[model samples]
Target: MGQPVMVKPTFEKLIPTIGSSFRCFDRTGLNLPSRWHRHPEIELTYVDRGTGTRLVGDNIDSYRDHDLVLIGSDLPHTWQSDQYLGRKYDRHSAIVIQFHPDFLGEQFFELPEFEAISMMLTSARRGLWFPAEVGEQIGAVMTRMTIEPPVLRLIHLLEVLSELSSCPSAEPLSSQGFAPSLTSASETRTEKVCHYISQHFRNPNLSHEELASHACMNPSAFSRFFKQSTGKTLTEYLNELRIGLACRLLMDSDMSILDVSLEAGFANVSYFNRRFRESRGMTPREYRRRYTEATETSNT
Candidate 1:
């Protein structure tokens, strides 16, 4: 019954246009709190600026300016921007497109010539990462889509997907177990559990019993089921979740070590320090100093 993570959307009030059930947005001047949320539509995102880590399903990777990614339906993801990269209003721009599988119609994909695209879509279940060059090329098309006519937009999308399917350097970003699915009772419970943990990572009072209750399951059953689903022990996963939050805080906020310890959910400063060192192979202060120095050097 480790705490659950809640996935919140950055933009909620702005809905897309009619006839275009799919939506696209350019996110700037904002940052996301880490959580896992999903929808039934596939997502394509291109980051024009900023640097941080991206978590798609169970895969975690460092992302720099100009990262392009495609996430399949129901794949959980978050784009975490570091503090240094968040200094300017327009410095973190991203192009995000969301569309259903049948948006182009079922018959479009069934055509013999679309076999590669079909395969690519199937493979997209695990998420996809494009090389910088490919990203740049695909990103150009996405940018064009903002101004193109309906018919031309479809053509551009087809070209982009074709290129993606043929690109040799593209890699899968999510773990092998990262299966795509519509939200169900079990999935909702899992999502709730993940969200709670993410939000309360710094709260020492949080426990498995409390989490199990949130999911409406017995403590023993919840513990066993969570482990089976995530491939990690309840405590271990919670610690990792805490550490992940701590890492983000360390890089994004000026909060001191003691404050970070409490904010990330360790009961005591000493235990937080010990676990931080054990999990990251360096002291909290040391990790921050090194990471900051490295970022500064890169910028300079």
Candidate 2:
């Protein structure tokens, strides 16, 4: 095979023009894809409306209106909006702010006055989700930022960060152990490998040899590279993907355990059961029941 075609993750280059410290996009009403992309800039996003799955690093969860999040530089992420999944009327909308770590100046955030905000940005490497109330408050300021002059908008961005630093409810999204090695030297190769896995992890017959060939590396070398790049063995990575899919199916579908196992690419239901228990600390049925109870309780 003449180098199997690779679908690499999109690298967004959002360089600002002359005299601009950062970029703000007020996407008032828009529908976008679940396109997995990354940039070197830290990002703050506020969802004004819509609901869907938000994926940051290896973390995947649902998001609704007034959702707000901060993503660190080079973290692969995407908001798979309801509209992107064919819920056409559920138009997604958000305000996105992007800036380099040293956008103001190389040592600006290192100053004593910026200590709290600086620490918050460091924690954001794993991504952070703010409560809806915080989202609403920050969203208003971000909305105004769209119309404000460049100088004033820069100041507003600092205010936003200052407020976020003190938010006690800010939750880290991605697992602390989940690290993506997307350095410039290996980014394209890593992105190709990751994107391919994302697209093909559902194949029960998916083999290491196949993946190695796709990445044009020998099996042993590929195994080491994969571990170093993603911090997981190939099997471990695939199981995480499969289990995540199974969880979603359990929550959103009425599929039987056997069917869920088969659909999620496990060769047998017995193995699936064992792996599910290992990963979740409970049987899939128990997980589903707990999730159902929680959902119903919230609804009530």
Candidate 3:
């Protein structure tokens, strides 16, 4: 098999090219997948308007307008925007800052005054999420960054980080399982497997043999490795993926339960009904009805 294609974030597209040093600025109206990429530079992102899901390492979470997050170096991550909101709301209107720890030299973080900032950086290796109020404050600072010079922008960026470090409510997104590993090849291979699964969840023909072949591993090894890495077996993971898609289709499409199940990759109605109930704790028809009723209530 060919070597897996691992995606990494490219800094070439940002406004005012960041050097091999610490930098800060605003990036407005951006919509692009960074892919399964990583870099040496740590990133802080604050979104202004959007609703989507974020995949940071192995953790998946739903995000909406005003979501602010910080990610560490060489940890795989991506954001997928909701298809319906793509045109109505700008997907990537936000502020982004990237900086290397060495930008301030090796001794800067060792100082007593910088201890909290240092800890924050270390904690961020697993990713961090700022609370709503703090996110708003960070978003405001990021908005101002677009108008400031490099020097002032960097200063304000430090202030922002300082404030974030002190916030008692800041939530860590990923834990030890999501920490960055030094092997790029392994990371890329893992991402390849995940992307493949995401794209093909609706295909009933998808099998363990095919996925293992795609990852260039034998079936048993791939099964073991995948479970160890993701904390879920291939069968369980694929079912969850399919059920997630089914849930969305149930809410958005007018298809019947049997058709929805068949479309979502189940072999037959009985099996689909059984699996759907197991995964969601409810029948597909009931889920769809409740979801539609809830949406109607919220709109009114």
Number of the top-ranking candidate, with TM-score as the measure: 2
Report the backbone clash tally of model 3.
Answer: 2
| Tens-digit lDDT string for candidate 1 (1-300) | 443345544222334566455676676653544445666678889987666557677665567667999888777677755543236323478888777788878687879999998888888888899987788878877887867666676677778888888988879977687453333555556666765665565578888898888878999999887765454557876776667667767877889999888877788889888888988999999989998999899899
TM-score of each: 0.68, 0.77, 0.71
Per-residue lDDT of model 2, residues 1-40, tens digit only: 2333555446889887566778898664434334567898
> Which lDDT value does model 3 have at 230?
61
| TM-score result, candidate 1 | 0.68
RMSD of 1: 5.5
Which segments of candidate 1 are over 4 A away from where they belong?
1-22, 27-36, 47-55, 59-67, 77-94, 105-116, 131-137, 166-169, 179-183, 228-233, 250-263, 267-297
lDDT for every model? 0.73, 0.81, 0.72
**Considering every candidate listed, which one attains the maximal lDDT?**
2
Look at candidate 3 and tell me the lDDT of residue 280: 78
What global local distance difference test value does model 3 have?
0.72
